[model samples]
Target chain A: MTEMLRVENLRVEIKEETILDGLNFSLEEGVHVLLGPNGTGKSTLLGTIMGLHKYKVSGKVYFYGEDITDLTPDQRFKKGIFLAYQLPPAVRGVRLKDILKKILNIDPKKDLPVEIYNYLKSLDLDETFLEREINYGFSGGERKKSEILQLLLAKPKLALLDEPDSGVDIDSLKLIGEALRKIAKESNLLIVTHNLKILDYVVPDSVIVLLDGKFVYKDGLEIIHQIEERGYDYVRRLVYAQNLS
Target chain B: MLKTYLKEIRERALKAKDKPAILGPDIDLEPYMRTIEETPIDDLEKLPDEIKENILYSGITPSENDKAGTYFQINHSVVYEKLQEIYKGKLEIMSIQEALEKYEWLENYYSRLIPPDTDKYTAWAEIKPTGGYFIRVFKGQKVEHPVQSCLYIKEGNISQNVHNIIIVEEGAEVFVTTGCLTHLKDQPGIHIGISEFYVKKGGKLYFTMIHNWSEEFHVRPRTAVLVEEGGVFINNYVTLKPVKSIQSYPTVYVRKGAIARLYSIIYGRKDSYIDLGGRLIFEEEDAKGEIVSRIIANDSSKIYSRSEIIGKAKGTKGFLDCRGILLSKSSQIVAVPILDAQHPESELSHEAAIGPINEEEIEYLTTRGFDKDEAMSTITRGFLSLEIPGLPKVAKEQINYAVAQLEKAGL
Candidate 1:
């Protein structure tokens, strides 16, 4: 199988502090989860992979075997890579329907009858919400659903969701998991979350443990059970043992 | 007020130039200037009813400075002759003096829409020729197309003070588009253009103004619309480029059951300075007003929008919304919305928002395959959408065109 996304020796230093240190990872066309503590650079790795271009990054990022370490977020987007931020900005006076229409160029009178209705129904959002400004005054769960809605609308090849289940409610979280599961069947999914409650709904094909900016272990879903039982002490011990060996 | 304003004009005229031992009468015609200033007031009593009605319908505000009678002579004589030639048969366009001389009683009907001495420029504008436009739409008159006026600065070093008065009688509809433009470069100039609109009950009047001037020019445009009961007035004022400084706030005074909507968008770039906003005053029941403004500033440019809504009458509803988008670090945008209500039963609301474009949102869009510029442009195209209820198809198309260009330019 071909690698969809590959990160080699990725070192990220933000404000003089190295957050991602010589990280190495790759994912095929399926679901992958980066699970770790809050400060383990899970989000940073996603940012670097998504071409955020803020931090000073050293090393290589390859999308489908092509070097994209220097590609901008926009270029990556055109190449079918997408990121769902944990905290999205509120764009006032811009309606959600208008944005969706502009981005997708969907003819609402003819084509949107079923597609839009099903999309909103899947997220349990009412039609009135479509006319309101984008994420303005939206609840935490609503913002997550909005992100999901964009995902469904844009339909990129790779989706890097930074803590997609962080602030979402249980019901919406389930919808998000289901949506992720549905989307991942056709596209690659890399979800970054500190807690694994979201995994209860949509299990990951592989789990990677990130510790102190480095990947300590890469295994199946059962590794998450190990973290649930042992904690960071076990991961740190493995990192120390590997460094000495 | 006119006397005080004229005294100041005289002082400014004295400082204009000094040719030692001037012998050519200094090109000052105080008597003719005084005739231009006071003749309208004097003719109000002597003119026939028909002529008086014509003058009052002309909508000219007489000179404020009773003293620089000489200043009006030095500045207005040439302006009057040129205006007479430009607007000979199609419509009646004149200065306050000529309107007063020709139709004094008519000039007396509705004069002071914007009070003089609100500022120096306004005060000076009140006295300087009061460049007035007299356009009359007969009852049941349907103008096939809109009429346009261009207040152009033809000379390199010149100050233009043009006042316009438009009246569309009952059962008539008229569309007027006026613009302020200049060709001079690196030269200091002042332009004060004021227009008064009176739409009789059941009359429809649409006014559009496009203002673009150079950096060395100080442009002050004060326009007012008085909509009677059952009248409808739509004013679309756009400022594409104001080089140096601009202070223009077109306002509307709607009576009972009238609808007034003003859509203004101002863009400030480079070192431009813009202090622009608008006002809506509702004085009767069932009257409504909406003011929407969008301002963008880049480089070291500064834009300030002050929109005011005064709801004093019952059943009156007014909404003032201002949005500011600042692009550069040095650029500044200050939007202040003030609402004053005397009637508790009236509905009044004001909202103001200022912030940079969200980087995360842009990142999301960019990751979706747009570049940084494309992301901003996409967001900006979204920003220009305002609630333009009952907008004409052509106006909507023009606004769409402007948005497309802005998006293409990456905001």
Candidate 2:
């Protein structure tokens, strides 16, 4: 099997405080989930991979056999790496239609392409919402829907989704899962989620449990089902037992 | 009597008092006044054809079959006018000289909003202006096409002062777009525009003014609008080129159930000092007002944005939004927004922010596909965008064209 992503001793620190310490993981072309308790550096790991300057990282991150540790967020984006942020910035005076136009590099005088309108229809969003300001006064579910919509348009090779189901309503979550389900067929998805309910709609091929910024278990989707049934405490016992050995 | 008013204003202009602190003490009024006296007005036949062709750029010049009226001014004089079929008998578009000689009703609105006694600029205009335009829309008639005007400077080492009066009678609506430009070779001249607008009860007036002058030009505009009950006044001002200096503080008065919306988008570059703002006075109950300013300072420019809203009656509401972006560290932007509420039930609010364009937003744009320059252009467009729901579609397209031109010119 070919390795899609390889992290060698990844360490992240933010403002003199260590968030992720010595995390090493490798993933192939498949759907994967990172499960951990609250404040266990799940988001930090994804942010480090996405090249956010908020954290200082010391590690080697290789994608498809090439080192991408020092690449910029935008640079990685051009190379087919996309992150659907949990909280997108509310940029005043920037409309959704305008942003989409810039992203797609369409002529300003032309109407939006039919493909995007069709994608929006599947999400049940009004086409007129394109004229409204980006993320301004948007509800939680609406924000999530917008991120997923961007993902569908971006068409990345490696997708890093940070808490895509946390604040989303059940209906939005189902819709998001359906969209990601289609995306996972072509992209290697690393979903950082706490809610295991989305797994019912879009099942992952592999599940990795993170403990204190370290991956403790590497197994198939059955491990995720086990963790869901027995809760995180069972994983904690296994994590501590493995660390002691 | 007019001579006495002129003498008073000339004396005052010599030693203008209480000038804003931002203007500093280095301002010398002697050069402008001297230029006004030394320069001679040119004959119409001797002028270049560009003076008339400039009106074509304003998109207001009437075709052979068109009924929309137009007034073109060259060196402070109205050189051409076309009040066609629809506006022939009912509407009146005349030079200030013609109006003073032909109509007695002009006295009721002339200088009523911005009197010659209001300031030195108005006073000087009263004393020395060559010519101007006087427009009166009949009561209850909606003017579908915009009345266009152009003020072009053809002479060097001179000053041009023109007074413009616009009156929308009761229940009437009119749109006016003015272009103020000077020749590229103008040698250190001054342009002072004094305009007064009156929107009668239930009337509406939409006005747009675009300024493009040479590097050696100094511009000073004095304008005021008075809206009666249930009236509306919308003003849009855009200046996207370099000039020596510009100072304007236009004002509007709102009556019961009336509204005043002021929008200004300015680009200051190449050592230009631009101080632009608006003042809204809520003089009656249930009045509303909003002021929005977008200032972009590049090179060594300095920009000062001012907004003052005064609520004197109950149930009045006002808001001010000021945002500035600086492209260079040497450039400066100062925002001063003041709110005065005398009545307990009146309310006013303001929001202001000045900074360089955000690196994160630029990076976010790049994540999609845009390079650095494209990202910056996109962000600049977003910063200057305004939500003008009631403005005409042509005005919006003109704004987009102006912004694109500015961007292309490396502003």
Candidate 3:
């Protein structure tokens, strides 16, 4: 499989506080799960990879063998890189359909394309939601569903999803998981989540465990069971033991 | 009786001619006192292409298509006036002078809402009343299309003073769009407009005004409205272009079970100084009022946005929202939202927010494939695109057109 994304010696700092230290990872064109505990820099890694300006990134981030560390978020987006924010900001007065029209380059006077309409249906969102301001008063589950809907519409080569399954109800999780499974067939997904319930619908090709801002373990689905049996502390101890040996 | 009323008004105006406004910088009225030549045309096509273009930019259609009537005033005279035959009896659109001369009872409605001695601008308008539109919708008739009116200033150093009156009879409905503009940039001018609006019992009136003035123009519009029992009044105001200074604070009085909604979207550019606001006073039970304003100040512009909702009667409710955006470092926006509950059963609330554009919103848009500039423009457009409740389709379209024009002008 061809490598879709590569991050080398990635170090991120926000306001002089180091979040991600020397994180190195490479992913092929498949579904990958990033498992980590709270405040383990999973979101920072995703934001850094997407070239968000808030993060002070020191290392190089490459997409399909091209360096994109200095590129803006829009430039990275043009290069088929998309990030679904963990907590999307509520933009008042900007309707979701209007932004979708802008992203699709559709005419202002024309209706939204049928494909997006179908996506809305598949996500179990009402068509009237299009007229609502983007996530302004949306529920937690609805916000997650909105993020997934954007992911499905963007269909980027590399999608960095931050906590796509968090704060979602079981019903919405199933809908979002199924949508992700469909999009994973055409795009590469790097999903960050603490819960493994979403794995029931969309199986992961590889599981990467993040500890202390670094990828401490990388394996198949067995790592998920190991962590389920013995919490993230087990993985930390295992990685510490390996470094000591 | 009319002559006596006029004499009394003139005397009162003369006394208040030197009185300064409570807000905004005082303008020296001497420079704009010079008189300019008036051009009155019988046909709309006779208007110069340049002047017509400016009029169109202010959201007035020059062709008069889809309009119930058209009133064009240039300098101190009415250039052209036309009313569609379909609205001949149901609606009336004519010059204020013509209406006053033709109708003996016009004096009762004129200057009744806004007194002539309220301020210097009102005083000036009463003393040298130029041409303005007089529109009235007959009782129980609903005018389908909007009546378009344009107040154009053609010469430099000219003072254009006009008094406008609009009356919506019982159970009547109408929408009026007025565009006030200048002919050229940097042409010093002063416009003092005294407008009085009356909405009868159960009547509805939607008034939308767009201002496109030059950098050397000073505008002071004194407006007042009276909403009778169960009547509705919707006012939409947009001023997107540059002006030397503008200070207006239109007030509305809401009677029993009446509703008043005032929406303003202002974009201040260059060295403009704008102090715009609206006041609503609820006088009877169950009356409701709302004031919403969106202001964007760019360049070195200074804007003061104020809204006041005074609940005086029992069971009256009012809400005031004032939001402003400062696009440049030197730009300043001051938002003042005041709510006064005088009666024990009255309820009033207000919220005011003034700040620069949200960086997070801009970045969020950029992540959706929009460039930084595109993101900023999109966010700015959204900030200014307010969905005013109960606005007529034509009025909303006019407001949207003005906002789009501002975007094209690189606002």
The estimated TM-scores of all candidates read 0.71, 0.88, 0.98
Candidate 1 accuracy as lDDT: 0.68
Name the better of 2 and 3 by DockQ. Answer: 3
Per-residue accuracy of model 1 over B1-411 as CA lDDT, tens digit each: 444444555465344323211111121222222212222223223433433332211111122121101111112232221222322343444445555456645533334575554444444455455354566666766554445454555344456666667877886776665545655568766676667788888888876666656777767676788898888898776665547777777778889988888887676777888877778889888889888887777789888888888887899998988887888999999887889897988899988888888777777666555567756766776677555778765455445554454543335
Full ranking by DockQ: 3, 2, 1
Report the C-alpha lDDT of model 3 over B66-168, residue by residue, as the tens digit. Answer: 9999989989888888999899999898999999899889879988888888878888888778878899999999999999999999888878998999999
lDDT of 2 at A40: 85
TM-score of chain A of each: 0.91, 0.93, 0.96
Per-residue C-alpha lDDT of model 3 across residues A6-78, encoded as one tens digit per residue = 8899999999999998877788878999988889988888888888888888988989999999999999988
The superposed Cα distance between candidate 2 and the true structure at residue B259, in angstroms, equals 1.3
DockQ of each: 0.35, 0.43, 0.76
Q: Ignoring the other chain, what TM-score does chain B have in each prediction?
A: 0.74, 0.88, 0.98
Tens digit of per-residue lDDT, candidate 1, span A46-160: 8888888667999999999999988887777768877887877776556777557645756534334467778888989888888878888989998888888877877788888
lDDT of 2 by residue, A16-76 (tens): 9988888888888888888888888888888788787667999899988889999877777
Which should have the higher lDDT, number 1 or number 3? 3
Ranking by TM-score: 3, 2, 1
Q: Of 1 and 3, which scores higher on TM-score? A: 3
